[model samples]
Target chain A: MNPRLSLNQATIKHADLATALSLTAEAGITSIGLWREPVAEVGLGRAATMVSDSGLRVSSLCRGGFFTASDPAERARALDQNRRAIDEIATLAEAGAPGSAPVLVLVAGGLPAGDRDLASARARAAEAVGDLAADAAGAGVVLAVEPMHPIYAADRGVVSTLREALDLVCDLPAKVAGVVVDTFHVWWDPTLPAQISRAGAEGRIASYQVGDWITPFPGDALLSRGLMGDGHVDFASITRLVLDAGYTGDVEVEIFNQELWDADPAQVVARVVKAFDETVAGQL
Target chain B: MNPRLSLNQATIKHADLATALSLTAEAGITSIGLWREPVAEVGLGRAATMVSDSGLRVSSLCRGGFFTASDPAERARALDQNRRAIDEIATLAEAGAPGSAPVLVLVAGGLPAGDRDLASARARAAEAVGDLAADAAGAGVVLAVEPMHPIYAADRGVVSTLREALDLVCDLPAKVAGVVVDTFHVWWDPTLPAQISRAGAEGRIASYQVGDWITPFPGDALLSRGLMGDGHVDFASITRLVLDAGYTGDVEVEIFNQELWDADPAQVVARVVKAFDETVAGQL
Candidate 1:
């Protein structure tokens, strides 16, 4: 019943699937989030079995929705690709055995290439989410629609708020559609506490990812993410809010800073775990 | 009538007040936005007289509200400082002479140092805004609460949306409190069109600033702005929206790119004016 700690693969981008798995297991973590590229590299079947046998859970899958392409042919290709992603999550969840409902984190793709129509892009993404409902439900995977920061709205995902993400799938059951609570993305949201409470009330809180907002953000701003206490995000309060929203789920510490990535994987893991313990889990 | 082109001073950061004034006037621009620093550098009286004699309208006074300090003494100091900003804007309004209702754009400052409570910061800002109601009304200056991009919510300004800004000043008369619609800051908002319409309907459209959203943003991020057509912002539509909302005011071009700053002041003015003509005003 101790707070579940899940390591997001991107946090250790250099680590291969084998090394990542072994490291997470060695760290005494029961859950490890999987990224599509790494899982595919290891072969989904092999990856699933490795995770299964290792007794570590696949807490979530790092994406399967980019339904914003404006071209008809490209849109069809995107849907087909998403179907395959859903199937992979389903298979991984099945292999992980009892109680493994691996959430498929869907990063609503940004505006279609060279297109400036955000409304249309968002509409297309919403429609695509509905189209995948049957496939996702059939696979017993929840579509965890994630809202990236507005900084990414132009060329990244159109879904950029918890309310917007939830509204996209309000009709679907919690197992079919939910929202990912990534503190790094949603921490600046003024209405987040209310939205988190609403998300909990609606039973659509899919996954919780945590990273702090550091200052003097990197030139490549995505890598500006910091370990919990290393930046401005009030983890204890947000975690409390998430917990209050009935999210007794895996607390994924997903830092993507260059210094962290450059550090020895073991050292990075130890440092991150210690930070999480002090900043998030220990405080709770 | 000619879509009143006004150059924001930050768009030509390297230029002295006199150079910026002459270049803008020579470019046939009828109005110019002023930042407090450059105006102060030239002596406010001389600067005001120069702007008045040059026959150029003062479009807006670039900022006057940072009422989010956590300390009681700091909060009182901030209020007093903003009163001076209001007084300065009033003097500029007076000096701008015929056909000028110069707006005082208020950037609600970000959270206080070492403060993690955004809700309190926002509340404090809201309160500070109300405190300025009397002074602003007396000065004949509109306190335009400009909502910054959410990325700045942590340390720059807590007002991150037009709706939030409007809510803070909705009860105040349009002449007392208004909102600045900088396309760069609010273009990503899904409810922008509606919000723009609302701002116009409420007569709270204080100012309209234009800048495009170029990618591979600069290290500072603020200077990543580009000319109208150089980025993904759909200025024609946004301009149309603002026009529809009854904003018959100067359309301020406010690019903050380092390259733009390094360019010859006159040349940058010409290029921006050309870009605006083609991408925004021409299309509109």
Candidate 2:
């Protein structure tokens, strides 16, 4: 197994923190990217201790951003939630082995319900990142904005491209905010290579996620991510671009397929290891 | 009803060419964008006659371009088919009432089965458009490249943004090639305003299509488009940009919702008119 391969917990959606860590270690992978829900279930302090016990690097914390709300109270609650997430990321990263990235992956939420003003929603999302900049910087945590595919533009994310995500954090220092280059979301961008290069040059590439875009999307658009080699994404080429762009971080395998989530966790980890080696691990 | 309003035949998918024309005329829509499949169902000449008899203008032809095939035989067939479609567009435009536009909307097909070379596939799609440029120009028709949303990037269109589509025809005259600004596909783009401005400035805005991007995409992503004012698209703002950028062509309402398709055609047309009037037509 590749040392830089990180098993993002979402790949084994039902696995508890202890189980996820055990699976990664047993599979010989050295890194793990965790989600807030599972972490919260275990309690943040216990989750941090679990990470220390596993002796694996925490590539990133799954998420912390849905800042498109127009209601002041909702907006304030979102900000407060993000600040807590930033603190969680700081604790988790500290508990992990050296080289762990203190990165909080931020997914800009979709438009506010019944709101058709996309520009204003996008502006609010950017402003929210700005609002969180100080908290992130103060905590030595990086807010990595993950721009989702345009398909989720209405309900999941308004930041639909790496360019837009990077634009939102341009004013902040790289240590305060950056971007995640998730293949599932950005594989179709014509400006991908240029933007990846720009991200590397600007030192804003805080995380590198690898996932395949499968065809015949499932009934739920959110579960459309597939195993690496089973879909149409050319991992070798995209991995090459990422390496060329100087992103030498852990290549996190983050798939969100219903079938995979239902499969045996150990078997899924084994398959992910093989797929990563065959498709993207070699480039890293 | 807005004189510039055009009913794209796909909005009434089950309607044959005759019924589609009658519906458009009865609904007070001054024009109709056609689909070749329905036109082929009645033979081109007779379909043209029906369109002419209806006394409505032809805004553009629905499609012609699946040119991402890797096989030489497939590529030739795609180009030949596009050429025929170009001739059909010319004939239909000539038969329609005055102000008819000889335009063929081209959907750049997805990657060939099992192939993941997006850059190569995109290049081929663009080259195919170049191959058809002469035919389109000769027929005095414009081949309008319709950039579908990135959600369709793998299986429907490799050209996923207005910027990429415009770049493909940058060297050609607007008369030979242009772009279709379908709001459903591009409403999520942060760069939409700038791209529309660029399209108008370059005289490449061949068609301005209106559709809505609704949430919880139905099981089939293809049928995800909702009617105008029924989803998150801010049509009034987009229409203002198009008008401000100087695109005076038909504002064609093209939707693909299952419910809308199953609804009474007259009622659907009425709803479209009301939606367009409330959401987009006023800006025109």
Candidate 3:
């Protein structure tokens, strides 16, 4: 198994924190990317302790952004939640093994219901990120803004290109805010190579997530992501692009497929390790 | 009905050429974009007579691309078929009412099966278009390259952005090789306004197609498009951008929704005209 391969907890969504950590460690994986819900379920302190005890690195926190709210009260609550998430990142980064990145992966929310103004929705997202930039900087956490595929622009994400994500964070200090280049969302972008290089030059590549886009597309658009090598994504090529872009962090295998979530997590971790080695590790 | 509005035949997929023509004309639409399959079914000569008799302008032909074939014989076959399509465009343009456009809409095919080399496949598509440019020039027909949404990059179109499509044809004469600016394919693009302007400045805006991107994305990804007002697309904004870019051509409403397909053609035409008027024609 590749030492740099991290099993993102979403791959085994049903598993508790303890089981997720054990499953990952048992498979000889040295790192994990965690979701806030599971960590909250175990209590952040207890989760930090388990991560420290397992001697595994926390690659990044799964998410912290959904910042496109138009309502003032809802916006305040979201900001408060993000600040808490920042503190959790600080705690987890302290407890985890050395080399764990204090990174919070952000998925900017989509258009508000019945709202047709995409420009304003995107502006709200950027402003929200600006609102939280100071908190992230104070906590020494990087807010990694992820660009989702355009298919999700209506209900999941408005930022749909690396160029756009990079543009949103360019004004901020790279150490405080960056971008996540997930293959499932961006593998089809023609300008990906150039934009990856630009992100590297700007020093804003916060995390790298790996997943494949399968054909005969699944019924659920969100669960359409497949395990690496099981779909059309050329992992090695994208992995090479990331390496060339100077990203040295753990590569998280973050598939959202229902089949993988339903299967034994231990087996899933094992398969992930093999897939990462076969398809991505060689490039690294 | 809006004088600039044209009904694209695929929106009424079950309708034969005659039925599509009559339905479009009965709805007071003065123009129609035709699909080659239906035109071929009636035989080009007979189809031309029917279009001429209907007194409706031919905005453009449905398609003349699929040019990403890796096999040498397959590539040659696709080029030959495109040449025929160009000839058909000329004949149809001559047969239709004044202001008919001799334009062939091009959908660059996806990556070859079991092939993950997107860059090479895209290069092949561009090369094929380059090969067809002279034939198009000879026929006085514009090959309108369309950039599909990135979701279809693996199975439908490797060209996934208007910028890339424009780049592919930038070196060629704009009159010989242009682009189709479809709202559904490009509404999510942040750079759409600028690209549309560039296409217009370069005299490459051969056709404009309008369709909305509905969410709760359907099971069949290909059939997910909706009528103009039924989804997230702000057609007025896009239509304004196209008009501001100096486009005076017909706006073809090209939807692929199964619900619309299953409806009566006359009713579908009525709904399409209403959607276009309420959502798009106002801008025009």
Candidate 3 on B1-284: residue-level lDDT in tens?
Answer: 78999999999999999999999998899999999999999899999999999999999997988989899999999999999999999999999999999999999999888999999999999999999989999989999999999889999899999999999999999889999999899999989889999999999899999999999999899999999888899888888989999999999999998999999999999999889889988888
TM-score of 3: 0.99
lDDT of 2 by residue, A156-258 (tens): 8899999999899999998899999999999999999899999999999999999999988778898999989999998998888888888878989999999
Query: What is the per-residue lDDT of model 2 for residues B73-101, given as tens digits with 9 covering 90 to 100?
Result: 99999999999999999999999999999
Alpha-carbon runs more than 4 Å astray in model 3? none
Candidate 1 per-residue C-alpha lDDT over A94-143 given as tens digits, one digit per residue, 9 for 90 to 100: 77636566688898887765678888888999999999999988888898
Candidates' C-alpha lDDT:
0.85, 0.93, 0.93
TM-score of model 2 relative to the true fold? 0.98
CAPRI accuracy category, model 3: high
Ranking by TM-score: 3, 2, 1
- Local error of candidate 2 at B270, Å? 1.8
- Candidate 3: chain B TM-score against the reference chain B: 0.99
As for lDDT, the candidate ahead, 1 or 3, is 3
Task: List the candidates' TM-scores in order.
Answer: 0.97, 0.98, 0.99
The complex in candidate 3 yields a DockQ of: 0.84
